[model samples]
Target: MTAIAPALVPLLVTLPLLGAAIALIAGRHRRVQITVSVATLTVVCAIAATLLTVVDLGDQAIAVSVGGWPIPFGIVLYVDRLAALLVMVSSVVLLAVLLFSVGQGAVDNDDDTPVSIFHPSYLILAAGIFNAFIAGDLFNLYVGFEILLVASYVLITLGSTESRIRTGVVYIVVSLVSSILFLSAIAVIYGALGTVNIVQISQRMGDLDQDTQLVMHLLLLLAFAIKAAVFPLSFWLPDSYPTAPAPVTAVFAGLLTKVGVYAIIRTETELFLFNDVNVLLMVAAMATMIVGVLGAVAQAELKRILSFTLVSHIGYMLFGLAIATPAAIGATIYYMVHHIVVQTTLFLAVGLVERRAGSTSILRVKGLMKAAPLIAVLYFIPAVNLGGLPPFSGFIGKFALFDAAAEEGDPLMIALIVAGVVTSLLTLYALMRAWNLSFWREEDDSAETEARISYLGDAPAASVSTERRVIPRIMTSATVGMVGLTVALTVFAGPLYDICARIGGALLEPVTIGQLEQEHEQSTGGDDKGEER
Candidate 1:
């Protein structure tokens, strides 16, 4: 079990930032931009994968001090087993989305898309996501969120259509509100503890009065909850997400909200340590599961349905986090990975469906199973996996989570568990409905049916018609690659769950702040002696 070099830490962020700059400079040359973006992310993925292996082999958390300052004063990039695994998965998803976007751009011939701005902004977005995963301090995490928000705002509104602009406004406004709350919480925490370093704060948070701690806890959780789109705060997601281009929607659905979930995980396990808010989180989890899936059931469009289901699945993650047990947290980790891949694959496949059928509305699209069997397979695999069908990662993850919850044997836990099962069933129902309408059902050719009137008594067209559009091979291939990763998750569920369980256990173990401080001092002392000599 060898340790990864700390030198690789800053590169995880700096490389993407550098790639963004190069991509911006090469904006006029789309091929150049694509080359640079792909190359940069490829390197990042390699580093992240290596780091994950190292951490999973029992290496301790790898910390890098930016520009050689000591711990409390300097920015740190920390990669433990959990952070490393997230970075690896995120990079893989980013790369796949980039390829999908590039392919879509090439096929569309750039009329409706802003190829230049998209490349650089996408890279910057990836940088922010990676930064968030490895940040070792509260302030740094906030920075990560701001970086992502800026890039996402650009990416979400890339097409500059009227609907996209409107939804982008909603997305940005919600993000700004969340950011403001997060910054305020950071300021108050710094004022109280005098340090925003996570370990330092973890060491001193117990000293705060219970009332103050509760205030801080609620403040942080409130902000993350909004970001995670849990239940009551989730109305914005379904509306904002479904309007974006498919690649944009896919990445946003897969990664952005999970960043919020990651923050909540850090807060509960690292910062607050399972405080009295478990009941609140549990209630929110149950409501999120039920309400989100119900919304999915009512939607007539594929992306909207997926968007609502996205909100629903966040409940499953919250369910595990609320439990706060090692097994529960491990299950949460597994589910997070599964959701990121399956959701992205589903959305990407939906993009293909839209390309083939001219629209994503279930009412408009029909007979895709007969028209595009490969795309149907691509969509079905992820759809069922997301619905927690057996012999898939989704099923494996949900089973682990339910087992953990039932072990608690509390009334609330039992209730949430039941909600979870119902949500899973409803998710499958909603998705299968879309599948049947958009793929299985045949359009009618009868003259009477063709001349059907509008509900408002307006005359209809002689017959409803659909023209299947060209789906680029590269676009389909990229989607297939993502779906393959989802299948791989199921195939390798055993080892992945083991890794997640170890990470969860490690997260619950307390850190010795004094020992960390001593190590920082010793390292700095060594640097000073070397300079003196």
Candidate 2:
């Protein structure tokens, strides 16, 4: 809570990057590479968690002006309760993925899995996410974006197998175009307002005509929309995400797009101010929910279906922002965190499913109950949670969100709320269909057993029978870990929800964000106030 405590922001972002550099240089020494990378992330998470605690102590935002200079001139690292909370949540998620990615008995690298640069690439990706969450300026955030984008490029293409490479190409092109759009948006904001600091832009945007502000705001939202995979701009998601390795795809589904949502939340509440964009954002949220779930229903592949669900869930976050009330946004925060874990765990479970079934295509995979009952449980928990089952965090989060909306008394919001319920139901039905087909039937090895290889399971040893079994340790382990996290979320629901409320409060009124901008402007003494460079 003290000045010294808040300064951990830079180190949190920098340390993992430092380790990533070490990994890239010493990649051949796999042991050292993994050790350094994991240590760095562990420390980063610790610092971030500490910061979150300090923020909970009500010290407001913890900001350190880098280089000992004030905001605008030197980079500022700001950690609000919201940023700190996300940093912590994301850190845990990424860490879990790291555990599964780097630990022994994970990944089939020795056999057929190629391009497993799980060490260097994963660390850098975590670093970028940290930087993005805490960055105090738009350009600083841009740097974070690039860092993650580049790392993701590597992660997606790792092993460079033909299919992986193909997915990587789609990812690269879409990402490049999004980056360009982001840069252009930033340029426009900088050119129009003479400042790239998000807080300053928010403060000054009111000076411009409403039309100009609208255009600029829409452009900025456009960039995040693309990244977040909102409908119409979401074509890139399903094409590329489901094709990557399961761990990579799980992390992407869980973290990458959510980062974009985080950005939009920051922009709407702190920069462009979504106060007046209610109608548009509300409509967009409804459309995103409907379209996304529709796509999910139509998908035949396990990962692809989850990917569609990922896009559909983005709508919930947007709904919170659109509603812009403390209660609604608070619930949105809870929803965001809940969805991240649920989605990530579900995707990881699918990985387990793929291991046991030898395929991810729903049509090709069947009889998981007969072939691997553990995979059935692995698949079911998250599916049930996603359906908003009670005793799970998903229900708590959605209940809060709906409660907030119901109090609004707007017929439109009421309708949107109905749409949300329908979406959740349809999502459940979709998952159920897949579950029934995969887990209910027998190993129709009423044909050939070897012909039905369990690609989703670990390579079998001579001792492990190739028969239909209800439990697989590896599959069970992944499912248990996931279920454990969800249960923790449920048990700690009050405290976690409290943290989210604080985050919503801090984000809604970003005074520290403003202070940083003011500090920057005073440090620069307005010599560079010209609109254009």
Lowest summed lDDT window (length 10), candidate 1:
453-462
In model 1, which regions exceed 4 Å deviation?
A: 1-4, 445-468, 515-533
lDDT of 2 by residue, 1-533 (tens): 34456457688877887887788788667668767866887787788888887767755566666776555556778777788888988888777766555532233532222223667778889889999998888998888889889989887876677877887888888878888888988998889999887777777887888888888778878888888998878888987887676678889999999889998888888876633687788888898899999888777677878888888889888888888888888899899989988999998888777666667666567677866676688789889889787878888988888888899978988988998999889889888877876687455644453334333233211112122212235445655686678778888999999878867776677564446654334333443334212
Native-referenced Cα lDDT, model 2: 0.76
Cα lDDT tens digits, model 1, 140-256, are 999999999999999888778898899899999999999999999999999999999888888899899889999999999999999999989998999898778788999999999
Local distance difference test, each candidate: 0.86, 0.76
Candidate number with greatest lDDT: 1
Give candidate 1's error at residue 475 in angstroms. Answer: 0.8
